[model samples]
Target: MQTYPIPMVPGPVVVPEAIRQVYLEPYGSGDLEVEFVELVTRTQRRLKAIFGTRDDIVIQSGEGMLVLWSALKSCLVPGDRVLAVATGVFGYGIGEMAQSIGAEVKTLGFSYDETINDMARIEAAIAEFKPRMITAVHCETPSGTLNPLEELGRLKHAYRVPLFYVDTVAGAGGVPVLADDWHIDLCLGGSQKCLSAPPDISFLSVSPKAWEIIDAVGYVGYDALKPFQHAVENRYFPYTPSWQGVAALYAAAGLLLDEGLENSFNRHDAVARFCRRRLVEMGIDLFPAPGAVPSPTVTAARIPQGFTWEAWDRRLRAEGLVVAGSYGPLAGKVFRLGHMGSQADKELVTQALEVIAATLK
Candidate 1:
């Protein structure tokens, strides 16, 4: 087998010792694996600590997309309009999912290079459309922009019309997301990005407000189809969970908690800032707007006119470094470096930048 130097790909970067220990533990469906239940509990508890939410949490056995699709199906009703703020590929996927379930979807969007629609604009759209649900992505990884969660929360509370659902798949644990404080009804997260876990588990923390609305609507009679409480109660998924994947998620969750949320966030922020600084110093231009909110987990840079992103990417790989290609509108024009997962720290970022600098020269 050929040995590779360093992997800077977006996910599955590296797993911590504590996380590895949890993965190595044996499994059983009996009382011996009762500790496995603890894994689930601890994962949720740690999430609550980070999200600052006491709301009900559900750990699903799939990627972030699974949770996103499930939440829309379970909550959104036929003919109900959903206000989707599109900024990237995943944002568009949310609208498509809502429409598949008979939702009258209306998108309030911007170009991939642009940031989110302003809160004032969102408020006006809400008043005009009177949508029953609002979907927003906290961090648009493809563009490296952070949406204003607090502002969105305030607008939702004021309108009191729609349920606010946030997709924080790349933002959670790395950025500040106060689910309870923001009064967001639904929030989804993934383990692979910021949590540094194997890519198998996704989680959602459902607010009481959402539960109340769900209970009042009272079973539309299709309990089997719902994703929130449905899959959990049934235990077998709509299909079987990756048992080993769950173990990995639990281990990763434990490691995140041990480092502590504040510390984790600070470390990520430092690395991102360092990366941005180095890129600018290397005469590279960032894609995101200056003075605007930026994603702490990923940084996107526009390739210089004479240099194609692929050429630079290939050169970096030859020097034993790896990064990601942009998605959708950004493809071929920009390259992204993820400052999340186990490698989301100063040491990893510094080394990665060093390799990039050598490649550029």
Candidate 2:
């Protein structure tokens, strides 16, 4: 496989040597190894701190979508009402996933270039729909926008919503995801994005309310969260666990904690701001709507007028610079530059931007 010299894609970021080194050595079986369970617990502790939650953290062996499906299936039964608040691709797609599982979903959608800020409209939806769950995406990577969850959380609490699910996959480590304060029941996360690890592990913070729903629903499948709920205590897992993936996750989470999450947030914020400023200086138009808040993890900019997305992407690739293209409606019109995890370095971003500048010339 040809690895791009510059990795500015949205996920599966270039893993640092510190995180990758653990995979080089051999480890014991995840099912029998007491240390593996300890590793899982320890990683969960670190993730809880990062997520700003006291809720139980469930780690599984798969990519980010694994836990996303797990959370929805575990907590909801067929015909359950789900109010999916959509601002972009992932936000809207998650709703479709719910529908696939037989959920009677009402998608409260917004423009692709915007974030979820219309709380009054959302509250009215919640009031009328009386959904069992309210789902949202904290950072919509495709559009490079961040939705403020504090107000939404307050609404969730005030309305007595049974569950509030959020996918903070792209923003968990580099951004603030206060699960407890936000009254989020299932705060979904991934290893690849801001966690600075390979894309093999998935995790989520499960609140007491979410656990209750999981128990009640009794969902059984490969993606079910129930098995994980007691796996540690029982010294077992649903399937053979990958010690390498868990170990990598442990190291990655530790790195974030050591740096202090606030510092990570500041670094990502500074880098993203700089990235946007430079893009604007180069006469590039950003994709986020005027009122939408841009994410600290990724920047989505309009493809320069003359070049088709295919040609622009090919040019960037020829220069050994690889960023991501937008999905859904924004496809072929917007490109995303990820600056999260190990790729969040300012120097790295500068180099990538230089390549972009040269390509656009």
Best-performing candidate as measured by lDDT = 2
lDDT of 2 by residue, 1-361 (tens): 8888888998989888999899998785556989889989999899999999999999989999998899999988889999999999998999999999999999999998888877899989988998999999999999999988898888889989999999999989999889999999999999999988999999999999888899999988888888888999999899998899999999999999999999999999999999999999999999998989999999999999999999999999999899999888899999999999888899999999999888878
Cα lDDT, all candidates? 0.76, 0.92
Global fold similarity of model 1 (TM-score):
0.90
- Per-residue lDDT of 50-147 in model 1, one digit per residue for the tens? 66799878777767777787677767778988999887777877888899889999998866766675777888998899888899898888888777
Task: Quote the positional error of residue 17 for candidate 2 in Å.
Answer: 0.4
Tell me the TM-score of each prediction against the true structure. 0.90, 0.98
321 Cα displacement, candidate 2 (Å): 0.7
Lowest summed lDDT across 10 adjacent residues in model 1 is found at 218-227
* Full-model lDDT, candidate 1: 0.76
Choose the strongest candidate by TM-score: 2
Residue 294 lDDT in model 1?
74
Clashes per model (N, Cα, C within 3 A): 0, 0
| Residue runs of model 2 more than 4 Å from their true location after superposition | none
